[model samples]
Each structure stands twice: as C-alpha cells, then as structure tokens.
Target: MEDEAPVIYGLEFQARALAAQAGETDQIRFIVGTQSLRQENQVHHIDFDDENNVINKNVFMHREGEMWHISASTVDKSLLTTCYNKTSESKAEMRAALWRLPGDFDDVQSEDQSSHQSLSLVCHLDATDYGDMKSVMWHPTGDNSNVVGLADNHIVVWDIDTSGNSAQMTSSAGLESKGQPKLTCSSWDPHHNCVQIATANDTFIRGWDLRTMQQTYVIENAHGQLVRDVDFNPNKQYYIVSCGDDCKVKFWDIRNVGEPLKVLSDHSHWVWSVRYNRFHDQLVLSSSSDSRVILNNIVSLSSEPYGNLIENDEDDDDDADDRESREASPPQDGVIATYEEHEDSVYTVDWSTADPWVFASLSYDGRLVINRVPRAEKYKILL
Candidate 1:
C-alpha cells in the first residue's frame, strides 16, 4: 500500500480545544472549537473518509465565548460540553456549559458548512460559586448521567438530566493549599469502573473518589514543573501517564506513587497532551508546545509486553550502512516518529474511537491533521 498523505483542514479563528466524536465505529469524526474575542466563536464538526482521503466539516455559531476546552459524550453524538471564556463588564471569566448540536452532527451533507445555526443550549454547568472552569470530563464507558468539571479551586461533579435539560451540582471538593492552587487538567480513572479521577493541581497530582468526593491518593511533585495533562492507561488498570512543563512524559502506577515506572524526555518545550492508543497501549502519543507530536512504543510496560514484539529487533542484522543511517534518525517502530505539520503549539491529540490505527491532532493555529499509524508498525502489532 502506498503511504497516504495526512488530510488537512483549517478553521477561521485560532483554537486549542478539540474532542473526538464518541460512540461511532463506521466513521472517523471530531469536534473542534474556535477562539475569537471580537468575532463569534464556532464549533466545527469534522469527518474524515479514510478510504478516499477527504475531510468534510459543518460549522455552527457559538455566541457564548471563546472555547477553552471541549468534551463529547460517549453515549450521545450530538451532546457535548465546552469550557469557554466569557467576558462580562470588562472582566474575563472561564465558564463551562452543556450544549447540543442543532441536528445530525455526523451527516456532513445534511447541512452546508455556512448554515451558521446557533448551538442549542442544553443547560448551564454553572461553577460560578466555585471558580473558573478549566475542563469537563465525561464517563468513558458509562451512560451520560454524570460529568466532572475542573474549576479553579474545586473538582465539581454534576448529574445531568437530559429530560429536563438541566444539571444539578451533586458534589464538589475544594483543592487549596498555603497559596492559591489552581486546577489545570483532569482524567477519569478507567479502572474499577471509572470510580476515581486524578486532577493536576498546581505541581501536585491528586486522585479523588467520586462516590465520596474525597481525596484518595496523592503523587507529590509528580512533575518538576507544572503538569499540563494526565491520562489513564485504557488497557492496564493501574498504569497512568502524565506530561508537563518539564518536557517529559512519565508513566506511573497509582498504587505506588513514589516514583514513575518510566520517563521519556522527548519534547523540547511543554508537553501538552499524552494519550495511550485505545486498543494498543504500547503505542503512545504526546504533543508539545514545541510544535511537534511524538509517537512512542513503550513495550515492556504494556499489557501485551512479550506478545507480538520484536519488529525492530528483526532489523538488527542489517548492513553497517543501515546501522549508521539509524544512528542519525530511526524508523517508526521503536525509534518514534515526530509529526510537525503545525506551525503553532499543538495542544490536543486523540486516538480515533472508530479506527485504532487512525488519530487526529489539533494545533493552536486551528490546523487539524488526520494521520494514521505507520503501516510497518500497524502490521507488526497485528502479525
């Protein structure tokens, strides 16, 4: 098979928020939000046809504010949450809310990209009493009944009633220390049926139990500087990954938080996002403020460490010229591949729920690139 070039799509305004459209297997889809202070912010529904290498999009006007972060429901395709920057009386405030697409977000041909339909308001995930909202997380595998939001100084949990189009604040926990400690990002613990969650508060990483809304575990100084993002290993129950301003991606076992299982100092600037491949946890991805995305194979610590391995090892007997070439820059398997299609800071990278081999990355300049696992790497895992 020939190598396919990445399908590129551009948005009107600068953006940093992106989410993979959930619960669909037949199509590759994602939602991207725009950030503009003077112009109306927009939410774009993007669809990629892998066979033909085409990108289709639908645009909707969001009159609220500049989007800070966005998340999609695993159950409802049209339902999503956005943490936005709303300015009132010359004061900028970050807020989060639940909104619904006008109709048929998956159907690209249903409406033209210039329809300019206003987003339907579902309900307000009001965290005003708490503080500025950072991000919202939905249950990975459960129904769309409960959602978690990271506010300035609190992890606010809410129960959504779609029938009434309203959300009720169920529980919230304060996270403050000597000085003001702001919550940066969060991840839902996929282990134990998603009962726990971890939040990056200041430079410390803390876990909380959803049932009691209390702290469960703490990894003090998990990163040398501020931690940007955290993600739970989907296949392994205890293993998790984190990246931060230290420009390093570290893996940890929450059970033993004293030290990290492994660390990779691959990015030159702040590592903004890290995600383990949904099906193959060994395949890891990390995007950085240095405007690069690195794909790594952390085999030894993966769920299937010994099985279907040795793809890179098979090439060890190559000629001396090949060895010299590899020393300068290696192949896609174990040597890792750095994607540099964006000119701005690449903030978010995600694996496609529909196709395990396909993934998407969004940069701050509103460049969305749809890429796939290297064919050699893909065949190595399957064969």
Candidate 2:
C-alpha cells in the first residue's frame, strides 16, 4: 500500500510578545509551504502588544525553486498600509518593501486551491450591499476561474475573465417564506453543467436554475436547527451533505425531495463545516464543535445497500438465506477514520487539491493542524 504523507501548506496565528522596557506588542505571522511538518511546520503566530501604537500582520511563504515572499500590513487609527518582504532575512526591513498604502485592511486567507493554479475571492464584510459575506464556493466546472459568493443578503456571481477581473454576472435578493430569511451557503451543482445553484437558510435547502433564476426544488426543515454548513460532493453533484446546530449530518439526494438518503449522526456537537474530497466522491471531511474531524465514506449508487436503505426490510423464513447475505454485505458507507487533533472547536477543514490524503483543519484556538487522511483496514473472523 502506497500512501502519501499530508502536506502542511500554510499556517496563520496570532502572537503576543513583551519587550524589556518597550512594553508589549501584538503581531500576526504566516508561514508558507516551505518547511516540512517536522522542521518548521508552516505555522505562524499572531498577537497585539501593549503599546497599541502599531499593529503588524504579515504573510510569509517560501515556494519551491523560488524566492520567499513575506507580506505585511500595519494598522494606524484610520490608515493601513500593506507591503511585501523581499529579503533573505526573515524579519521586517526597509529595502525589502514591495508596496505601501493607507486604507482599511482585512486578513487574507491562504489561496492555493490546487497544485496547478491558485484562486481567491474577497468580499467586503462591512460593505453596505455585501453584508457579512456568509459563504463562498468555487465554480464546480474545475475551471478555477469563476466564483459564486453568498453574501450578507445577496447572491453574487463573479466570472473571472482573461484580464484578471471578476465580472459580477448576477445578484439576487432574499425570500420571505416562513421567515426563512436569505441564503447562507451556496454551491454550484457538481452533477450538472453548473446550471443549478443550491443554497441553505435557517430551515430550507433551495435549488435554483441558473438559466431561469427559478426555484427548482426545496427541502423544508432540512435541519432541525440552524443549518450551519452545506456542501455538494465534488464527484456526486446530485447528492449533498448538510450539518447544523441540530448536531446531525444529513445526506440528501436533490432529485428525491422527500427525505435524506442517509443521516450520519456521529458528531457530539454542532456541525460547523463539511466538504467533499476532490479526489473521491465517497470520501468526505467534516468539522464540528465537538473538536473532532470526521472522515466519511459516501456509499456509491452501485452499492446494493444504498437502494435498500430507503426500502422496507421484510424477510420471511423462506428468505432467511437472502437476509443473511444482505446482513453480510458491507455497509452503504462507513466511517473511514476520525482525526482528533484540534483542542478547541474546529471551525474549518479543507482537503488538498494537490494531494488527496492531505487535509487541513482550523480551530477556534487559532491552531492549524495539517495531516494526511489515514487509511482504514477491516478484519474478518471465520466461523
């Protein structure tokens, strides 16, 4: 069995330090994909010092066959400046400055979505129209060029053109059904030609046709509590998984509106985020307030137990052998493994497009843990 170790690509943290007589100062540091998990581990520290005169937030990365880049942002009352580090030295310097400015600045998350090319989309959370910028998803076509943003109260589409500009293609308002409010998490359907968009609110998962801007389907009471996260499998678009404050992860078949295909109730607390692995439709990664990351196997349609899940289980003595056979069959899907690394609530978890086994987790404590998805083996007993 050949398994590739996980990649620790980037890390962001807050670090606080106290000087002899200078008092305290807080600074943010980001370590890029330079050192391996053992050496430097791509972890950065963030913090604010006592002086409060200057605020420093920096982004650092050492790319393969390339020079290191460290970006810095300093805050002062109403002014903010961003500059890049261009020196062999790791500390802030004068000659290595790349750019400077005066304006409001927000933290930029790591961007490299895949090994081929990196993609990034930014939203003004405090801006009037965008409001909160709740969720974001990349176009499912694997183009990595376009993005669809679900904001405070709007659905905005950005088409990445050749000139390096994201053109806003469309924006839609909210719905007032049973006080369901507006969209929170939106995704481009993976099974189709990016023609359908699915969004979740406090109570419903609604589907809309991109061509007609009409509701195609709606699953009400999708989650008993506030639907916190929803995601479409990159490989299985018709199927989606949603987790909520209700403390349940439900799998749904968009075509079958009545009920979820399966309900995976393992997390002890609210499920905050869920995502499908780019490499395998059967593999999924989910994070929860329980401080654990769960790896699940989504049963394929080809599996017999899948179809029978929504079917009645009625067996007579004459069919005893058949029932035994069915009992011996493997599960529709099973828990592959669980990574209990984060000490606090894990807020976000993402799979590496470059490596299938590689995944990363971010927690409320600001600790980022990157590791490989371990493989599981089954043991059998003969009678």
Candidate 3:
C-alpha cells in the first residue's frame, strides 16, 4: 500500500514536509512566523496596508456636512481621510490623514450639496484626548454626523457640529464605575432603527438605547465562559444570538432570561463568531475554533418546524398514532454546511448587506475567504 496526498476542493494537492522517510512518502510542512512570541504560538493582529501613508491601526467611515469622511483611530495624534461625495463615483480613493487634536473631535459641518460638490478635506477632529480607542462606529442616521467609540469600557459619542469650535459635542457613558475593561464587541441594532447598541464581555451582554441614554436590556451569564460575539437579527427585536468559549451557539428570545430559546451544541471547539443572514431569518452561519464554518437552520426550535401537515381526525383501528408516539424522535443535528478551508482557527465571519449570498471570513493563519456562502443558494433569500 502507498500513502496518498491531501485534497482541496475535490482535487489532490501536494506539499513537501520538512521531515520525510528515506524512500517512503512526502508530508505537508507547516511554516512558523519569524516575529513570533513563542515559536509555537500563532500571532494574529490587525495590520494596515503598508502602501498607504496612514499609520492608524483601525479605520472607519463617518458623515460630515453633505459628504462622507473616512477616519483613522490613533492615540495622541489625529489623522483623517479626505471627504468624498456620499453617492458619487470618486468616493473610493479618499486617503486618510493623521495629526494632533485639542479635544474629542473636530467640528466639521455638512456642506451644501449643490454648491460644494467636490470631495475634499472639510475639517479635522481633535482626537488627542479620546485615549486608547478599542473600537469605533459611524452614526447610522447619516444626518446627525455623530461618531461613537469604546475606550476602556467608556462610550464616547461625538456630535460633529461646527458651532462648538474645533472640538465638537461629546457624551460619555459607562465611565462612572471604575475598574471596567474595554468591551470587546459593540454592535448597533439594525432592527431598532439603528438607535441602539449592545456590548459583550466575559459574563454579560448589555444593550443601550443611544437616543434615551438608558440600559435597555442585560443578559447575565450570557456564557459560562467569555462571550466571543453577540448579534441581533435585522428585523427581530425579541431575538439575539451569542457564541463563546463554552463551545455553544445560543439563541435567545429576550422574553425569557432564564435560558436560551435553543442551545446548539455541534462545534468541536469554541465558537468564534455567529451571524444571521439578514436575507433569511431561518438560516444562521457560524465560525468556530475547530477551523470550520457551520451553516444551521434556525427554525429547528419552532413548535411546528416543517409547517402544518394534513391531520386525519378519524381514529384508526390499528392505533397508528399510539404506535408512532412510542418511537423516539432522533436528537437534533445542528450543522447544515461545514467548510474546512482555512488551515488555522477562523476568527470572524460577516454577511454582506448588499449581497446576502456573499460572506467574508478572517482566520488566525491570515486567510480571507470572499465567496458565495456555503449552502446559501439552497436556502430561501428573505431579504
């Protein structure tokens, strides 16, 4: 008997291993990073494009005046990308700039669309005092021109109004209580008119109503271990899903706080990310620490999952219903699709709003997949 090569996408792929027997067979070799902390540890951190002059480690888009501005997150210094028309062809190339600031943000008002048609630098923000920003998000309204960020677990909401001087209006939350760590993930509720945001930590998930400045809802012990990601359905306010180091993807109805509406336990390792397809409420996609992506049908929890079936009211002489009840139904199997492309752990996965079938995945081994979502074509497109 002879050894065979590994396969990918139904085709055999071969690679040479560092250690091989004298005349036996070849093996696959794995490469280690030269700039690694420990030779065996995988270091996966965010990296900016070296070709671009901007030095900020993170980037986001914000609206100012009548155009849109792309900004960077930097500590002690302030740099911004040039402005571009909100709906024009030249919006793609506006590169970001970096500098110092006087306060939280720069007052750059929206411009008049008819007269000020060109995309250029309208103004700059004073981000020096903002301090180590862990994450940033643009105002979803597209008119208020506010930018929100999380720093040391404190939320900073920036109002980009010009009457306020170089620095603009700022609001802070979650700062009263000290000794709080930065919330790892902050997600805006797309279903609530985009006026609410939710944050996740080791033991809890907190929802904040941006317009009311109130803590809307809190899920205690969202996971026994750290909750890696939290997401809300685009049209369902009563529902949310969470995944974590516990290796479980839980679906919650918010109505019940004691337990999840359903607990999916199929992943062999910790779940890194879980996403609901906005186009279809019944389809959920998840990426895990097992180096695989799983697609699941969300309707398995429903009372009448397969829809109404014709029922015969007449009693049968053979007692068929009694006999059928004695046979136990099989346990639920979670996975609908399993993708095993990445050689390392998959960290994140997101579905495109413009194209639901198209999704993206980022992995610890520096692999990015931007193709049709697995089994997306088989499911109904609800969007």
lDDT, candidate 1, at 283: 95
TM-score of each: 0.92, 0.61, 0.58
Model 2: residues with Cα > 4 Å off, grouped in runs: 1-127, 142-146, 162-166, 178-180, 300-332, 377-383
**Candidate 2 lDDT over residue span 1-383, tens digit each:** 54434322223332111001001112222222222322221213222221332223333332211212222211212111111122244643211111221122233324332332211222211213544444444454434444455654466555534334224445455555765475656667866777778888886888887666678999999999888777787665588888888888888888897988888898999898787766565677788889998988765632222344432347444476666676667555778878876777877676544345555666655555565655442111000
Per-residue lDDT of 366 in model 2 = 50
Return whichever of 1 and 2 wins on TM-score: 1
The weakest ten consecutive residues by lDDT in model 3 span 15-24
Query: In each prediction, how many residue pairs overlap at the backbone (N, C-alpha, C within less than 3 A)?
Result: 0, 14, 12
Full-model lDDT for every candidate: 0.87, 0.52, 0.50
Candidate 2 versus truth, CA RMSD in Å, comes to: 14.6
User: Which structure among the candidates has the greatest TM-score?
Assistant: 1
Candidate 3, residue 181: lDDT: 49
* Model with the higher TM-score, candidate 2 or 3: 2
Question: For residues 253-301, what per-residue lDDT tens digits would candidate 3 score against the true structure?
Answer: 7667678888888788889888887666556878887988787776554
RMSD of each: 4.6, 14.6, 15.6
List model 1 lDDT by residue over 1-383, tens digit each. 76678888999899999988875666898999999999999998888889899998788888999999999998888889999999988799999999888887555457565568878889999999988999999998854499999999799999998779999999999875767689999999887878899999767889999999889889999999999999998998988999999999999999999999998998999999999998999899999999998999987778876543433565567877775665555323354577888889999999898999888999999899989888877886786
